[model samples]
Target chain A: MRIGELSRRTGVPVPTIKYYLREGLVPHGERTSPNQARYDEAHVHRVRLVRALTEVGGLSIAAARDVLALMHEPGRGRLGSIGKVHFAVQAARQPHTDEPSESSVARTNDLIEQRGWHVRPTNPARAALAGVLDYFTRLGQPDVLGLLDDYADAAEKLAVAEIDTLGGRDVDHMAEHVVMMTVLGGALLNALRGLAQESAASAKMT
Target chain B: MRIGELSRRTGVPVPTIKYYLREGLVPHGERTSPNQARYDEAHVHRVRLVRALTEVGGLSIAAARDVLALMHEPGRGRLGSIGKVHFAVQAARQPHTDEPSESSVARTNDLIEQRGWHVRPTNPARAALAGVLDYFTRLGQPDVLGLLDDYADAAEKLAVAEIDTLGGRDVDHMAEHVVMMTVLGGALLNALRGLAQESAASAKMT
Candidate 1:
C-alpha cells in the first residue's frame, strides 16, 4: 500500500505518517521508486499501535517511542523482553520523584514486605506509591491512608490476571499487549470506578 | 495570620494564592486595611486542597474552580450535594468524545443494566467507558474487553467504601473529599496497580 492508502485505511493523515516515519515510530516502507514507498500489513499494525498509545493512552511521543522500542527488540529472551517492557512502560508513566519522603518510603517498603510481593524497592511503582502517600501525609488526610490495603488487594487481583494474559500472546506481540494493558488498563479501571461509584451513590443516596 | 503565613504553611507561593483568590478558587481574605488582608486557618486548608487538585490530581484551573464551587454550595442537601459533586467531578475528568460508537455505547449500557448499576448512559463515566471500549473495538483487541467485570467489581467495592466515608463528613467537607477521592484516588489507584503489576510480572516471569 502507498502512504496515502495507509493513511486512508488507518485514518491517520499522510503528513502525520511521514512525521512518524521520520521519528522512527513506524518503519520505513519499501521504496518502489523515487517518492514512492510501499507499506505492508506490519506497518499498518504498527501505525495502529502507535496511534493507540499516543491518542487514546495519552503517552507522549518519547514515551510512545520507548514502547515501540519494546515491540522491536530482537536480541533479548522472552522473559528479558517482558521485564524490559514492563520497566519501560512503568518508568514512562511514573512521575519523577527527586525528593521522596522517608516516612512514605518506609511505609511503601513495609507494604511490599508485608505482602511478600516480588517487587524491588527501586521499582518505579514503589516511588510512585510513596509519592501518593507523601502527598496524603502532607495534606493531613490520614484516613485516606487506610484504604491502601483494599486498593492493593484489588490491584493484585487485576495485576495477576493481566500478567496471566500476557502468557498467551506471541513474543512479537507481547510488548504491545503489555503496553496497552498497563497504560489503557488504568483508564479502564478509572472508568469502571466512575460507573460503580454512580451505582453505589445512587443505591445509597436515592 | 496573613497571606504570607498561609503560603508558608501550605508551601504554595503567595502569588499563586493571590491568583487563586482572584480566580475565586479560594475565598477572599477579609481586608484588615487598604493593603492588608487577614487569612485564617480555613485559607490554609483551602490552599492545600487547591494545590492537591491542580498538582497531583492534574485538574485544570477551570475544573478546580468547579470542584471548589461544589465545596462552597450552601443551600443544597447532603444527598443533592453528593450527586452534584459526583457529576461535576466526573464531568471534569471525562475526555471529550466527539463521535461515540453505537456498539460501544450499547455494550456500556448492557454492562450497566447487567450489573443493575444505577448509572445513566448520559453520565460522563458511561461515555468514558464507551470511548475506551470503542478504542478497543477499533484496535481489534476484544480480549481486553473480558476484563471489564473484574475491574467493575473492584470499583464497586471501592466506591461503596468511598460513599460510606462521605457520609461522615459535613456537607462542605463532602465536596472536597469527593473531588480528592475522584481525582487523587485515580493517581493512587494507578500507582498501586503499577506496584502490583511489578509484583505479578516478577512472580510470573522470574
Candidate 2:
C-alpha cells in the first residue's frame, strides 16, 4: 500500500501523515520508486497509535514521540517499562510552574504511608496529587480534602482490576497494551466519572 | 485595595489582571479616580477562579468565561446547576470532530441502563464515553473493553462519595465548590490512578 492508501485506511489526511512522518512519529515507508513509497500493516498500526495518543489521549507530539520510542526499546523489565510509561504520561500532563507546597507534599506522603502504596518517591503522580491538594487548600475547601481517602480507595480498586486483566497477554503486544490502557483508560475513567456525577447529583436532587 | 494590591494578593501579574478585566472574566473594580480603580475580595476570588479553570482545569479562555458566567447565575436548582456545569465541562473537553459510532453509543447506553443511572441522554458524557469506546474499537483492544464495567463501578463509587461530601454547604458557595470539585477532582483522581498503577505494577513484579 502507498501513502494514499495509508491515509485512506487511517482516515488521516495525506498532509498530516507527511507531517507525522517528518516529525518521526511514524516510521518512513519503503522506497518503491523515485516518487513512491509503500506502507504496510505496521505503518497503519503506528499511525493509529500516534493518533490515539495525540487525539484521544491529548499528548503533545513530542510526548507521543517519546512514548513511541520507549515502546520500541527492549530489555526494560515489565515493572520498569510500566513505571517509565507512567512517569512519561504523568509528567507530560502536569505543568511545571505549579510547585506543590511542602505542606501539600507532606499530605501526599501521609496518604501514601496510610495506603501503604509502594510507589516511588519521585513518581510524577505524587507531585501531581500534591498540586491538586495545594490548589484546594488555596481555595479553602477542606470538604474536598476530606474525600482523599475515598478517591484513593477507588483508584486502588480500578488499578488492581486493570492490572488483573493484563495476565496472559502476548509479550509482543504488551507495550502497546500498557500505553493504551494507561492513556485511554484515564480518558475512559474520567468520562465515566462525569456521567456518574450527573446520576449522583440527580439522585440527590429528588 | 487598588489593582496592584489585587494583583499582589492573587499573585496574578498586573498585565494579566488587566487582561482578565477586559475579558470580563473578572469584574471591574470601582473607579476611585480617572487613574485608579479599587478592587475587593470578590475581584480577588474571581481572578483566582478564572486561573484555576484555565490553568489547573485546562479549559480554554472561552470555556473558563462560560463557567464563570454560570457560577454567577441565579435560580437554577442545585441539580440543574450541577448538570449544566458537567455538560459544559465535558463538552468543552471533548473534540467536536470525533463522532461516536452507533455500536459504541449503544454500549454506553447499555452501561447506563445496567447501572440504573439517571443521566440525561443529552449529557455530553454519554457522547464522550462513546467516543472513547469507539477509539478502543478502532484500536482492536478487547482486553480494555472487558474492563468497562469495572471502570463504571469505580466511577460510581467516587461520584457518590463526592456528592455525600456536599451536604450542609452554604448555598452561596455551592456553585464554586461544584466547579472546583468537578474540575480539580478529575485531575486529582487521574493523578491518584497513576500512582496506584505504579504500586500495582510493582507488587505484581515482586
Estimate the TM-score of every prediction.
0.88, 0.94
Off by over 4 Å in 1: A2-4, A13-23, A28-37, A95-98, B1-5, B13-24, B27-38, B74-78, B95-98
Candidate 2 docking classification: medium
* Every model's DockQ: 0.57, 0.68
By lDDT, the best candidate is 2
Measured against the true chain A, the candidates' chain A TM-scores are 0.92, 0.93
| Interface RMSD score of each model | 1.9, 1.6
**lDDT (10s digit) by residue, model 2, range A1-206:** 99999999888899999999999999999999998899999999889888888987777899999988887777544556756766886777764336788999998999888898998878988998998887788787889998888889989998898887777786557778878887789889888988898899888878
RMSD of each: 2.9, 2.0
Distance from true position, residue A17, model 2, in Å? 1.7
Residue A126 in candidate 2, Cα distance off native in Å: 0.8
Model 2 ranges off by over 4 Å: A74-79, A95-97, B74-79, B95-97
Flag clash pairs in model 2: none
